[model samples]
Every structure is written in structure tokens, then in C-alpha cells.
Target: MKNIEPKIKKLTADILKDYGQGRTIDKMNAFTSPDMDVVVDILDKLQKILFPGYYRNKNYHFYTAENNLQTLIEDVLFNLTKQISMYLRYLPEYSNADYRTGMERAQEIAMEFLSRIPKIRDLVETSVQAEFDGDPAAFNKDEIIFCYPGMYAIMVFRLAHEFYDLGVPMLPRIMSEYAHGKTGIDIHPGATIGRFFFIDHGTGIVVGETTVIGDNVKVYQGVTIGALSTRGGQNLRSKKRHPTIEDNVTIYSGASILGGETVIGHDSVIGGNTFITMSVPPGSNVSIKSQELHISSKGRPDAEAKDLDQSATWFYTI
Candidate 1:
């Protein structure tokens, strides 16, 4: 009994040590970190500004309309500038001088980006129209604005893409990744998506960096606009690494269109579950045939009588 008591005490000590270690590790990676929550709050405010009356449920009297929005906008700009400065300070890629210059550049870029909000709002209105027109079950534009994950993803992408264009390092990707985590739509910060774009059931969609998608393009879930391979590191870094999809193209679910040189021409329809690597001409339809499955019953005389050649039975075209 004495030996058992010591063993139990030792096990309890080990468990307690592990618990304490876990708490320490968790503290280091806590979401309550100022950087993380500040960025998240900035995004929340941006969303509220982008889609008024959809996100925040604050009671504003008639007199407070202009003042409230103006205050919120100023707050967003100030917070964003501070966050950008803070992020640049922590990132090891930039030197002290470079960080200062980059922060200045980011400030200018952010101002330009904020200036484009009116245009973005117009684009989002088109997307809302597209959603309402595309889905029969959609009740109203308000529902799409309020509840749709696709709209949220697109909004973040548009904002992040602008930052990416302005040559801000890491922040755009971080912003887009935040949206990706929430919506399951993986739109790269550097992807060039045009106005009036719509992503239907946007989960699992991958728009790679350097992908140039033109106006009025629609992409469904599980579509991968990606690169085929990166043969060399230096060559891959600055070069185009994703497919160029021209205007009025619709890529359905599970379609993987890959390679830098690959271009989907204007007015094309890519069918669901198709794998494409080469260029497609304009006004074309690409699809993959459904695969067939065979089943054989055991302990049946009729099934046994059937000639089942192993090589022939296993092979089938998709």
C-alpha cells in the first residue's frame, strides 16, 4: 500500500506539471493579444461601414446619422494606421528605416484604399443583385448582405487585394486569411479580381496569387484557380503563378484550372469537377464525365457464372 501511494503521488505530480505547462503555452498564444483583436475589430468596423444596418445593431437617433458614420470612419482609419505601424514594427523582414518608410507607404496606400470604398460599395451592390438573381431561395438583398459568407469573403478580398496592389507586405495576406478562416474561401491577397464578381457557396474556393480574373466572373465552391508547378524559386517569385480567367467566365464546383500560362478565354463555362491545365478557347464548355462503379455479389450462382476478368473489370473511363 505504501509503494502504491508513492506511485500515485508521482503520477499526480506529472499531471499537475503538464497542466501548468499547457496554461503557459496557451497564454503565449492567446487570442486576447492586442494585435489580433485590434485587427479583428478594425475588420468588424469596416464591415459595418460597408454594409450599413447589417452588421452592428446600434440605436442611432435621426440627428446622429452623419456624425456617427463620420466618427466610425475616422476611428477605423486611425486604428488601421496604428495597427499597420505596429505590425511593421514586429515583422522581422523590414529594417528600422525600411519599417518607417513602409509604414508611410502603407498609410498612403490605406488612404487610397479607403477612398475607393464608394466604388467597392457599388460593386458589392452588383454582387447583391447577382446573388438575388442567381438563387431562387434568396428572399431579399438585405438577407444576402446580412447572412451570406460569400459577401463577407468578397469584401475582405477586395480590401486586401487593394493593399496587395499597393505593395504592403504581410498585412494584406493576414487580413484575407482572417476572412478565409471565417468563410472557408481562400482568396489570395494578390489575386486580381474585377468588379461585379460573385462567389457562390464560396467554401473551398482557392484563388491563387497572380491570378487575373476579369469583370463579371462567377466562381462556385471548390474551384481552384492555382499553379501547376514552381520549377525554380527565383523564377517563380516574380512571375505569374496562377491561371488568367478572362471576362464572363463561370467556373463551377470542384474545377481545378492550374498553371501560369493557362488562360480561360472570355465567355467560357467550366463544368463541375473538371481538371484543366491548358488554355481553353473562347465560348467553350469543359466537363469531366462521371465515373462508374461496379459491385459483385458473393455466394450467388448467377454472379459467380459471370466472367469477371480482373484487368478488364478494374479499368473504366471517367
Candidate 2:
């Protein structure tokens, strides 16, 4: 009994020591209550501003409209600038001096971003109209603007892309990634996407950095607009690495379009389940056909082969 007690005490002490040394605590610190929610909240406020009456409560009186909007704008600017500054401090790409200067730069960038809100709002309005026109089941623009996850994702991406262009590190990616996590539409912060862009049932979609997508484009689920490789980044850092999708193109589900120099022409229809690495011509239809397979045997056929020869036993192609 005495020996067993000593062994049990040693085991407990070893377990406690291992627990202290394990990556569980590190993971908790890294993942618990992410600071990215600050950026998400800023994006939510921007959404409210973009669609004033439709988004938030329309309680502002005639006299309070300008004053309330101004106050909200200033508050959002302050919080976003502060968060950008904080993010710069942690970004390994920037120096300490850069981090210190980033605060003032963030203020300038935030103001510039705010100034573009009118234009952004116009773009979002057009997108809402597009959604209403595109989806047959949609009741009205309000339902799309308020409830559609795709619209929410696009709004966040557009706002984040503006900040990304202003060279605000980490915060832009954080905001875009938050939208991606929520909507399953992975639009990179550096991607340049134009107005009236629609993502229908957007799941497993990847838009790589440096991608350029034009207006009135529609993408379905499981579409991958990605890079061919990062092998050139072994020596280069700012090289173009994603595909360029022109206007009015529709990429169907499960299609992978990859390459840095791959330019998808305008008014093209990319069919479902197609794998494309090269560029497609304008107004072309790209699709993949299932290959037919035949089975035969020269040796003596056994009972297993006879069983496999039946049409019911053979696996069919999609």
C-alpha cells in the first residue's frame, strides 16, 4: 500500500509537469477570444452605414441624421485606426519604427476608407439589385441585403480590400477571414473584385491574392480560383500569383481554375467539375467528361470475375 501510494504520487506529479509543458495552454492563448472581432464590429458598423434604413434601426430624426452619422463615423475611425495600429505592432513584416508610424498612417487610411463609403454604398446597392434579379426565389432586395450570407461576405471583403490597398497589415486579412469563416467564401484581402459580383451557394470557393475579378461575375460552390504555385516566391515576394477573371463570367461548381497568368475571357461559361490551368477563350464553355473504362481478362475467369462482369457489380461514372 505504501509503495503504491508513492508510485501514484509520482505519476500525478509527472502528469502535472507534462500538462504545464504541453501546447494546450499555448493553443488556448492563440485561439481564445480572438481580437479580430474588433475588426468584425467595425465592418458591421460599415454595413449599417452602407444600408442605413435597411440595416440598423431607423430611429434617427431629421435633425439627428447628420450628427448621428458623423458621431458613428468618428467612433468607427478611432476604433479601427487603434486596432490597425495594434495589429501593426504584432506584424513581423514591419519594423518598430514602422509600427509607431502605422498609427498616424492608419488614421489617414481610415479617413480615406470612410470617404469612399458613398461609392461603396452605391456598389452594394447595385449588388443588392443584382441579387434580387439573379435569384428567382428571392422575395426582394431587402431580404438579400439583410439575410443572404453571400452579400454579407462580399460586403466584408470589399471593405477589407480597401484597407488592404491602403497597406494596413493583418487587420484586412482578419476581417476577410472572419467573413470566410462565416460564409465559406474565401476571398483574399488583396483580390480586386468589382461591383455587382455574386457568389451563389458559396462553399469551398478560394479566390487567391492578386486575383482580379471584373463586374457582374457569378461564382458557384466548390469553385477554386487559385494560384498554380508559389515556387517563384523562393526569390520573389511581390510577383503576381493568381488568375484574372473578366466580366460576366459564370464559374460553375467544383471547377478549379489555377495559374498566375491564366486570364479567363469575358462572357465565358465554365462548366461544373472542370479542372483548368490554362486560359479559356472568350464566350467558351469549359467542361470535363467522365472517361469510360473496360475490364477484361485473358486468364481463366473465376467466380469473382463472373461476379464483377455483371452490370450491377460495375461502378458507374457520374
Candidate 3:
């Protein structure tokens, strides 16, 4: 091949020039941002703490529960403190301070978060029970805790919510996004979800930020409890954008309950594939009018099948 050293140098110089340009993509000499791998490791350790016996690492030799917990908690605490400190340095209050100051603040927040473990566990237990009671396919509570993606998603959301509540920026959203990557359920850490929340067959579910869900609420797959419109963008930040789901409500699969003002009253059953932007009264069963179906045999003539297809917009009820 012909000499390519000059071409390589030219390409490198061009790429370096792009970096030098005054755009917002450079983090050249700033303090290190939160590491995704470390955040994932924190999440894994938190899982063990949250559900004690459900997820155990075979690599670690466990002599006793107390001994194992003591070790795991220290390891997780060190890493969590470091990660939180890194993110906190970017905040306005911590911006002028040194890394040590951030670490001090992080330690305080970490300790407070750790202290809430018992309450978190209590809420998680209710979630596990919710999954067990709601899903008929669940063999036992243990099975739901171990195998359900909904439980995993909700557990991570609960943990992240604590961080969100404490106002530790970036870490909570990272934790939530990590769980979202593993499970198709996308629950925003900013959402306020109450006790005994169950998510069934939770794939393609989007629980948006500022959504308020009350106790004993169960939602199925392909549900979007989201904002009616996001046209306002940052202008709508910190404002209620999603709907309020009251206690003892069941939102079925493929349901889109949008708008902040839309309140789903208690004891309501929102049927599958239903779209609601308006407030639903208590004990209301909201469903779309069933459409007629013309089932044609596969062996039927092509012309007959084509005729059946002319009745556009097919819908399935749940």
C-alpha cells in the first residue's frame, strides 16, 4: 500500500480541531462524571440489600447474613459515596467547592439513604406481594421477586426515588435508566408511586415524570401514563404533566392515560387499547365500543379476504 502516514495525521488534526471548537460536547479537563459501570455495580449491590436472599452472588462466600451484609454495605457505601460526590461536584452549590467538600455532602446523603433501607424493604415487600396477588402466572412470592421484570423495574425505581427525593442529581436518573435498559419498563424516578403497586407483563410501559399513582394500583403491559403534550419543553419543567391515578385502579394493556389534569378515580378499570385524556369518575369502567369482527378462513378466496380487509381499524379488547 502507498504511504498513509500523512493521511492519518490529517484526519487526526481535523478531529482535534472539531474538539477545539466552542460547542457544548467537550469534557476535556473537568472532574470525572459518574461512571455507568460503577452505577450498575451500586445497583447490583443494592439489589442484594433490597431482596436479601433472592439475588446472591456465587463468587462471594457467605458465612452468615449479618457478616455478608456488613461487608456488602461497606463496599456499596464506599462506591456510592464516591459516585454521588462526583455528580454533586457539577451542581451549582457544589460547583465552587473541592472534591473533599462534595464527598462530605455525599456521605451525609448516602447515610440518610442507607438509613431508609428498612422502609424501602417494607415498600418492596408490598410490591412483591402485589405482583404475587395480581399475576396468576406467579408461582409464589419468591418467584415473583426473582423472575418478574416488573418487580426489578419497580425495585430500582424505589431506590432511585429516594435519591431523587434527597435531591442528589444525576445518580437517580442513571439508576432508573439502567433498570429501563434491562427491563422494557420505563419508570421515571421523579414519579410518586404509592404502596402495593403492581406492573403485569411490563414491556413497553412508560410511567412519565410527575405522574402520581396511589395505593394498590396495577398496570399492565404497553401502558403509557404520560403527558398530553410536550410542546412546552423546558417551560413545563417541574410542573405536573402526567395524569393522577387514584387508589385501587387497574389500567389494562395498551392504555394511554394522558394530561396532568386527568384524574383516574379510585375503583376504576381502564380497559386495554383505550385512550383517555379526560378525568374518569370513581368506579367507572372505561372501555371503547367493541368493533365487529369478520373472520374469514385462510382457505377462503383472495377476493373474500380482501373484502374483509376493507373494514379498517381493528381493535382488541382486554
Candidate 4:
């Protein structure tokens, strides 16, 4: 055991060293990297804070609500500030400073962000209202907030957007990815979304970093507002790549709207499975017709129905 232990320790120690490869970081400075788990924990706490009665613990008495909330807020603030400081340390700008000095900026940013919680709550409430209004199955705003994946995704995006707006790197992406993993709705923190925006069904939705969405826009599941091309690589960083969605637009499921030059103008109704790459004028009702459709007999995959009737087509009055 002693002989084998020495060999294993040496191998482990060798791999621990950077070896001039930027991929490996030193263990002593491990705290400089953001903690993903802690950031998610912060999100969980923020959720309860954002919607107070929705996640109440029955064990806690009514009189204890304020005290419990206060403690939770303080705990989340401390952990978030620590993680933010660590994230900032990864940049060349903050690497030269001592821990206390580096954390000062983090503290300031965290305080400013916390102060905006009321506004965030208001924005999220409007998003919930949008979901409730858009979905026929949704019973109420409370149900929408509790059950809708789009609402959950939007809530996280709004929080992450605050961090992104404050110019705090890494943490915003972490928050967005956390939501994307849970909700299957990929809304980039860098995306500028206006008030009362909702995504129905929400699964497989991809909203790119450069996408700009105005108020009162509704999108169904499997929607992609993405780039026309990515061959430009890092050369296109911070350049507009995704499409712009104007107000009062309804993009249905499985639709792909690509390119920065592509804009869905106001009061537009984009149909399901539509693939668009060019700009759409305002008040346009875009849809594809004459597409072939095949259906299988009930409970029989081998029995196929003939193509859809050419004269029969689905349409929406916008």
C-alpha cells in the first residue's frame, strides 16, 4: 500500500501543476473562480424572496416571516457578493488587488442589485401576467407563476439581466444557464427583452445573445431567434447576430428567425415551422402553405395517412 501510495501521490501532484498550460489553475487561488453551486443556491433564495407566499414553509409561524426573510436576504447577499468577487478576480482588472479591495466593488454591485429587487419583482409580475393572458390553459397569475416554464425562465433572465447590465461577468451566464437547464428555455442574459414578454410551452426555445424583443411579444416552444451565420467566429463578438422581435408579435412553435438584419415588425403573426432569414415588415401575417403532411393511424405506426388536402390550410387572423 505504501509503495503504490507514493506513486499515485506523485502523479496527482504533477497533474495539479499548471505545466505552462493555461487550462490548469493553482489550488491556492481556487477561491478566485466562481462557485456554480453557490450561485444556484443564490437563485433559489432569490426565488422565495421574489415571490413571498408562494414558497412558504408551514413550519414557520406568520410572525417569523419577516425575520426569516431578513436572514435569507443577508445570507444570499453575502454568498452572492463572494462569488461575484471571485468572478471579478478572473479578469486582469481585478487580479492585482487584495481580497478586501477586490470585494469592495462586488459589495457595491451587490447592494445596487439588491436595491433593484422591487423593480425586478414588478417586471417579473408583468411577465407572469403576460403568460396568464397568453395561455388558455393557465387558470390564474398564481398558476402561471407556479407552473409555467416560461415564467420561471423569464424570472431568472430578469435577475441575470440585472447582473449583466451591471457589467458583472460570468455570474450572469451562470444564472442564465441554470434556468436553461431547468426550464429548457435558453434566454441569454445579454438579450434585451422588454416588459410583458412571454414564451408559451417554452421547451426547446433558443433566444440568442443579440436578440432584441419588444413588449407584448409571445413565442411558442421550439422557437429560435438566432444568427444567419457563425463562420465569422469570435470576430462577431458583441456584433448584432440574432433577429429583432418587435412589439405585438406572435411567433409559433418550431419557427426559426435568423440574422441580425432580420426584424419581425410590430403586429406580426409568424406561423409554426416557419424558417425566416430576411426582415419582415410591420403587420405582416407570415405562414407557409402547400407543405406536405403525413399522419399515422391511431396506435399504428406502420399505417400512414396520405398527404394533407391541398385546399385545406390553417390560418390565423392577426
Sort every candidate by TM-score, greatest first. Answer: 3, 4, 2, 1
Pairs clashing within candidate 1: none
- TM agreement with the true structure for every prediction: 0.76, 0.77, 0.87, 0.83
Model 3 TM-score?
0.87
TM-score of 1: 0.76
Deviation of model 2 at 253, angstroms: 1.0
Q: What is the C-alpha RMSD of each candidate to the true structure, in Å?
A: 11.5, 11.7, 9.6, 8.8
Model 1 clash number: 0
Model 2: CA > 4 A from native: 1-34, 57-63, 90-94, 98-102, 231-236, 292-318
What tens-digit string does per-residue lDDT give for candidate 4 at 1-318? 559988998988887664546544534554556788889889988998999889754455656778978877898889988988887876788878898987899999999999999999999988988888778898888888788889999999999999999989889999999999999999999999999998899999999999999999999999999998999999999999999998889998998999998888777788888888877656566776656221112221211112323233334222
What lDDT does candidate 4 reach at residue 24? Answer: 44
lDDT of 4 at 234: 100
Candidate 2 per-residue C-alpha lDDT over 1-318 given as tens digits, one digit per residue, 9 for 90 to 100: 558988999999997777776584633444322376677778777877887676663554446667767867977999888877666655555446464587786687788989989877787777787788888989987789778888888888878888788777788888888898898989998998888898887888999988899999999889999988777665545667788898888889998888878887777778787777766555555655565211223232433334333322222242
Q: Which one wins by lDDT: 3 or 4?
A: 3
Give one digit per residue, the lDDT tens place, for model 3 in 282-306: 6556667765221112232333134
Worst 10 residues of 2 by lDDT: 292-301
- Tens digits of per-residue lDDT for model 1, 1-318: 558988999999997677676554535534322376777888888888887777762655445657878877888888777666655544565436455585685577668778988877887787888777877778888888878889889888877777677666677888889999999999998988877788888899999999999988889999999999866867688789899998888899999999999998777788888788777655556666556222112222333224543223221243
Best by TM-score: 3
Cand. 4 TM to true fold: 0.83
